[model samples]
Target chain A: MTTMPETVVPDTGPADVPPVPSGGVRWALVDGWTLTRRAVAHWVRDPAPVVFSLVFGVLIVLMFGYLFGGAMRVPDGGEYREFLMPGMFTMTMLFGVGHTAQAVTADLDRGVIDRFRAMPMSSAAVLIGRAVADLLLSAVSLAVMVGVGLLVGWAATGSAGEFAAAIGLILLLRFALSWVGVYLGLVLTGPSAVFGAQTLEFPVAFLSSALVATGTMPAWLGVIADWNPLSSTATATRDLFGNPGVGGEAWVTQNAVLMAVVWPVALLLVFFPLSVHAFRGLRG
Target chain B: MGASGDAVVVAGLRKRYGGKNGGGLDGVDLVVPHGTVCGLLGPNGAGKTTTVRILATLLRFDSGRALVAGFDVAERPDQVRARIGLVGQNPAVDEVLSGRRNLVLFGRLHHLGAAAARARAGDLLDRFGLSDAADKPVKHYSGGMRRRLDLAASMILSPAVLFLDEPTVGLDPRGRAEVWQAVRELVGRGTTVLLTTQHLDEADQLATRIALLDTGKVVAEGAPGELKARLGGDRVEFVVRDRSRVADAARAVARLGTAEPTADPDDRRVGVPVAAGATALVEAVRLLDAAGVAVDDLALRRPTLDEVFLHLTGRPADRVEVRK
Candidate 1:
């Protein structure tokens, strides 16, 4: 294309920006905190989705607690609501993993990740910030589930210490699952990933002992259900919360709490670096 | 920092995507002096976006050097990023967040203190005429408002150099004009800008210097006026009313120009480049009348960028097929 040549346009804005001061840990933390707050602000400004997810999780709990409660019989003759609470709590934490995928993918598709990468801030801050925010939300969501469990006549007969330990295990799983979210977000970009995660949710949750007793199932299916990673946390929570349904000769049942901690730790070891590597690869 | 005064300098930049994809740079070279708007003009697959991506440190090059704001893009990318701002082809701001919140979020990510980020966000919102809509979520914003908010987000640090890649790719005429005015204000503020666009008129209106890229190469580079002037004097175009007399009319139109007249069988028209302007027009009309060639329309027009693109690249500018 051709046109007239104007005189050289002058620079009038500020020039010679001072070099960005470099500090490793402090800057990363600060950047991460800022991004976390940004995510929180997003939730606050548009709470519809957040509220919907919370209500939806509770709705599932209520449906299973009341509607399906009469049909499900625990092997130990305990209230189905009591047995279902631990299973549902574990499922809720695993379900939070899907949110991580959705959030990460949304950021990637919207190019927010690109903007963050272009900045000179800490590279891990964006992913870490997202995980931290989601973890905090998971805690709130778990509290709501626990509250719903109490209203439905579900109680932990264990001590306060055991209850605290059970909550900790559930949240640790949530934390690990969030990194899975981060990895999936980067791997499967765009709006479709949200629906994909939603579609995979029920199958993943049901394939374990979250809502049904492994002892009531066929031998092969029961063994598989007992060994599912989510079963570690569900069995551990049942034990820690003084609920029913924990009978197996395998070491996984004998050491439910230990597996609960180990499972998420193993997942974190795998997904944390993988997610960071994916984040780093975006610059390419 | 670059060894030269140019805010941006690139040499022998090369990249390849391998296989049938086939869209990357090949031995590209460019220079934009400090504080001037250099229009990177090209078609869809001209590698204009790739060049900007390399300079912005968004994509790594296989070979060669790119310097932005005096810092080498590959070696000192962080420094380059601190000094440069990029507005990509699509609007990247968050739709769920308010316009003000989006700018503030970017400011915070850049490591500005909370108060400082807020102040800058407010300042930018006002500067870009977004104060009226600052409190509303970006989803409520128009195409133009979103583009302006994107500009505001990129300006969070008042970057020394700003790279706008097709800033107005899908806006209406009024929106385009609004963005053009905003760009003028940005240049007036002394921020050096590099604008890449497919719209020739956009480049014509904004760029002080034009770099014509085609198929991953800098095919031509100069001031827009210089490029047009280099094409030589005006051209005489006329269509014959009677299709059968086109050859007779071409002979008539040929005698009055500096070179042989070219005829288009489809339009039944003929065009000739001539050194003489009005005299050539009168001479062509007289010659055509004497030959009894019925004429429908005739005129002498200056060379537009459309003709220049055709003259240099041998095709229209918009007919490029972008490859993934």
Candidate 2:
């Protein structure tokens, strides 16, 4: 306190000593887990969003499966509930984009992302943690939707191995969409803007074969629906579960399993890098 | 790497956002020596936050040399991050997590072990007076408590330098006082802090040295008293009973100081900067009485930082002032 701060020119002290350096993939993994715990803590503190997600999925299934089952027509003439279950599963994965974008943008608006960037932790930690957390929650909602489907007399007549494969494909789409959400979150400005981005999910889900067969639609509309990534996943899952509404002549629908794998893989390839680039460009 | 003893050294720093909102630095230079509180005082949109962000390694500047804690911000940002903590204008803590949990969470991110992080969180909760509400979610904490929690989080690693970008922007009086006290405590522990504030009095109260930043560049830099002294040592002002006598009073007071006296006819006030203190005030009073000027009010006071800022930047720092 006695010495003039500008004129002191003192020797190096403890404050000048830097902390031990952190590096490599190991640190990134550790930091990612730490941030994942942060997301889990938020879920523990406020479970409303998680519960709402589950209830919403079940509500959609009930409204489509039972309410319109008799009136709705399956392409191959089967039970409407059976046709609706796989579409509902694919819809669950598609809706995850909204959640991912909202969470990312909310953190950005609140300055939490800036704080994470300022820390000495690995840069990839924030996005990785977000993806993992969203996937975990998505899995929970998927299971609940599956249970609701079973309650409505929807069954997977395929082998258990095929059933697991269907689940994997659904999650793969979700995982790819999470990156898309992350990119959208990093770019969108405010809550209203994020809401606007989330609203786009409705058109995407409805236009695809998530609720009805593309065969019943107009020819042009059917062509668009068959090419939709959501339709590909839904069609592939229907094939795996041995459910109804599997009739389609288009190349994408005919090779549904291959398209299911290609679509999410393509989405990941495009959006994963895009999300990272957007996150880094935030400083600029 | 920096050979200088300064905690932060920024020279010729320039950044352009290339948009309608052009709030970026042109050519700014600043030097904050180790273990001192340097207040970057400015009005809104003066690039204070930009400078702090660049120095904190959270922003990229166009071209400049910025070194924090002996590491260049551009070349060795990771090293700078290892040695610095930042409390942005917004409270960045997790809203759903408790204050203690938030601190512990930050500690783990800083790479502290589980037990170490918990112990550090406990210590910070006690130090920041957040123990009573440690278990409660941060969303439940009041504005002051949240700001305090933010301060506590920034201190988790006890970094060499701390960048505070308007730490008390929207806080109430009590909240502002609490933040000021916490900042003073940080300085007492020998932490070098570069604090940006829109309040001139805040700079006066907390800064060892104050840098007047305006329109993206530092217009003036010195100790608070030195800055006040630069506007001339002291001022003796008198409000006359009759507006007609304002000039008469000004003329009488003119002979007492080296500078010419300024008379405000609307307010009937005459003021002049003076080198001497009580004797100059007494001398002006006797001269005014001899000149038949009836005085309504008068006082001899040192120039406030607001006046100093007004003189340097051609504008007041802020319209509001805190009474000394």
Candidate 3:
């Protein structure tokens, strides 16, 4: 037989095929779904952390409802559980931000993020996918805490539509805060920095109206609480549940709702790009 | 790109870390042919991995023009990434997920639909001999098994070109062999591979062509045999019967050959370089006998790749000492 050619032909099979009709947004959604499902599956395998996180929420609710409920009366025939539920919901969303930082740090340490950076997927997909995943985990955590509250005699007097709207509002706030976690995770160098950032979560949560009504706090402190994003979510959830409104002005009512929506949107605007920039700067 | 085309081309690739004296790659140039395995041979700090990272689109080059599969890495990184797969020194699989799940995750990331992703994961598990542990958490995998899984993960996208940076660095001999077998199978399927390693033997075995990197430059490059042949001589080594006659034997052997004879004082051996065939061997023996120098043992050998590396780098291949 004749000698073979010096160079054989390469196999350029279907990778060179036509591009898919999917746009960047569709790709992001699919990637986000995949990432969220994977995160949930990981939680299924290790449920201890989920339980541990819920216990913290339960403790906060029980301590405030029993120890302080006798001294602080709920107007309009509302029970302490109703007042405590909204705060717990806000606390859950805020605490879930720490999980985002933890997950991103894990991905960074394991070099999974680097692997994604080298892939053909959209650059923004990595961070958005992670945020979406964290949001889903936050939803599950919120559901469990709410279910436990109901079992402990908490009830919502509002219509089902209002409750659904409250849930949507809580998710929007969590989704925004998730970007803060994503941004912090990308900017921090190691796990120790992540833990340090996590320490700030508890103080931020407690400083808001999560544990006590803003009206009972010092005048100056109450002003700060009214402007806090957690306060907005907590107040909105309390209003939807037909619980007694903590004394605040008309500005506080509109500002809380605006802050709740604007905080995540603003965070997405700033931290979203920051996360992408950090991802790009990883090797540097 | 065609097999006859250039699979990867780099010109003036430069990168520097942000500390004093922390440059990684400096003014590097390289080209890899399609459908061929190019071994990037270097010691720990020789910038081999840096070069591979730039080509694979995992790290950016401060200033350079790098084209992988005909796409500029800097200008069109996603396109470059689409055509190449990188199996870095560390495995990038999710430890919490099962081996099959990890594979399926990557498959989906490559845009393969659910059913196709599952089917591909099953096939890869079998191919990598991970079928038994397919459903087990990769956190429980041994180093070698994890490496196999990492290599298998890169193939899910069916990339046209593959980059392996020290793929067998921490593997046992058997694991290395298994990886070699898997690599050969990939080559048989027409995947172009660029593998970097500090192991000389690995380069000799796996590379169709090798580039020896020193400091920040490629000092020598060619096929192993061509590099060896360039050293120019069949090596002749023999032990002299008497230590005192070593001087005389050296002189006699030098006289019989065009090259100089070297004497090892501690081992009582004299080695001389000669051309092919027994003529020079017989002449050296006769000259030694005339000088009353007895030979205890004699043998002629061809130059090894180690000798080629030593001759080119002006230092022993295994004992390369990098100055900080």
Candidate 4:
């Protein structure tokens, strides 16, 4: 047999060439937008979770407004439906944490997350996309629940500007809570841990004044409720909806809107890094 | 050894989990030249996947240096990631979404525009022979179909370097051939492929060079022909009809060949290794016939990758345990 000379091929090709970029952050943003859009498309196809979350929020409002509204008196002069609307909004945000974990955990189990990690996109984009998609779904759920509440005798006496402020607060809270879900979804080992992480929402919601006024509760429990983050959001949402304020010291000083933003910001600050760290650890 | 430039260079790569006692990667060193398919051959727990993960920037190595396409894996992971496409052992396709949607999703993540992503998705689907199933949810596809789509997903960006971690482990023979064809096509297009596989034939068929890893270390590395040549000569075996004629057959075979004949007492079979050529077999048949021993069956076979693996690893390939 004739032996042909082996040709030595070049190791570096035009494909190995790197793009010249002035800023890495610009590439990250571009990649992040793509990831966000992909997540949105995923939500569009499988919308049951989104619908379930919204309907669940509406049921909670219905049960509380007509069944428990008369039994519990609002310190402010407004119908129970109006008093509970803000709390229902907070519940909507809280309910989203579970769905976020479920979606993320499913992705992890399916190896989709690992595939993304191997890509050239910004590492932070994965979590950011998840948060954005969940935030949008939560906003839609809030709008639907509010519309349903209005049909069930809930009325907002606040001006259009105040209504906007309440909606903004709801969005901010959801954005922050989405990060919490993203963090938990990455850190938790499996689906069971996701369920366990969701169990925290019940105590957090009940400990706050979302369902009742802190004044009527025992002094010790009232102290806990006053410090609860959800209570701060509920108080701020109530004021924006034009409901009777809890009055002096208890109402004005609560500053729920500011606290609502702070809680999520703090959560994102701590958990965002934690989630990234966990994702980095996934390789091990 | 030739000092070939490293398309993929890894040195002293070490990774451990939990503690020192825990199972993880050990110090692994690999050098893959450009435009070559280097097969990382090993059984389970050989740390082949871990090495690939580090090279792909999906996992960090605890120590040692890893450079892919001239960028440090740990320090400049994004740059390394930009150069590589990883098709892992498991199918990573989104089952709820259609195959077309899955491709689009990956394309978007690669930062391709909407129109470009759609175009690439269609091209990849057609290339992998999945165009018919593109609109169906991945859950509706068979295992082989899903694997093909998963591979297509990795190729969306047309990366310069590709890492395939057991890409055809569970595929049927037909599916395996299709994947092999796709890989050969990719290589023909000038993509450098670093693949890990348990199948010896796969390595022999596709890899320009094979690295046999055992217990997280390279026991042998060479071209398939070189490794097989090192294992010695061809194998010749034949069965005898009468159990009483086994020794007579062995003695007769020993007369024609300098090598000793090994007789299997239970089956009355004899086997011997001989130098390359049919002359040794012809001489053995003549001697056996002269001794009046009837042969039940006779066959001459060349060294297979399985034999090379057994010689290097000291255990059969099927005995190795793979982690799910």
lDDT tens digits by residue: candidate 4, B100-185: 99998887777677887798888777777787878988888876777778887888767878899998988888778778877887
Q: Write the per-residue lDDT of candidate 2 for residues B1-324, one digit (tens) a residue.
A: 345789999899998777634457889999999999999998777788889999988889999799999999998888889888899998899999998899989888888888878988887777777888899999998887888888878888788899999899898988888888878877888889999998878898999999888878999999999999999889899899998888888888887776988888987778998889799989988998899988977899899988988999888877533321
| Per-candidate DockQ vs. reference | 0.36, 0.39, 0.28, 0.35
On a 0 to 100 scale, what is the lDDT of residue A169 in model 4? 82
For the predicted complex of model 1, DockQ is 0.36
Candidate 2 Cα outliers beyond 4 Å, as residue runs? A1-23, B1-3, B241-245, B285-297, B319-324
Model 3, stretches more than 4 Å misplaced?
A1-23, A63-81, A215-221, B1-4, B230-234, B238-249, B256-258, B277-324
Q: Order the candidates by lDDT, highest first — what do you get?
A: 2, 1, 4, 3
Of 1 and 3, which scores higher on lDDT? 1
Candidate of highest TM-score = 2
- For candidate 2, write residues A1-284 as lDDT tens digits: 01112222222222333464655678778888888888988998899998898999999888887787779888788898999999999998888998998999889989888888888887877998998889888888989989999999999999999999999999999999999998888888887888998888889998999888888889999899889999999999999999986588899999999999999999999988888788878778
lDDT of 3 by residue, B155-230 (tens): 8766878999888978888778778877777788878899998888898888999888776778778887777777
Q: What is the interface RMSD of candidate 4, in Å?
A: 8.3
What range of 10 consecutive residues in model 2 chain B has the weakest lDDT sum? B315-324
In angstroms, how far off is B41's CA in candidate 4?
1.6
The collision pairs in model 3 are none
CA error at residue B71 for candidate 2, angstroms: 0.9
Two-way DockQ contest, 2 vs 4, winner: 2
- Give the TM-score, chain B only, in order for the candidates: 0.89, 0.94, 0.89, 0.90
Candidate ranking under TM-score, highest first, comes to 2, 4, 1, 3
lDDT for B18 in candidate 3 is 59
Q: For candidate 4, what is the TM-score?
A: 0.91
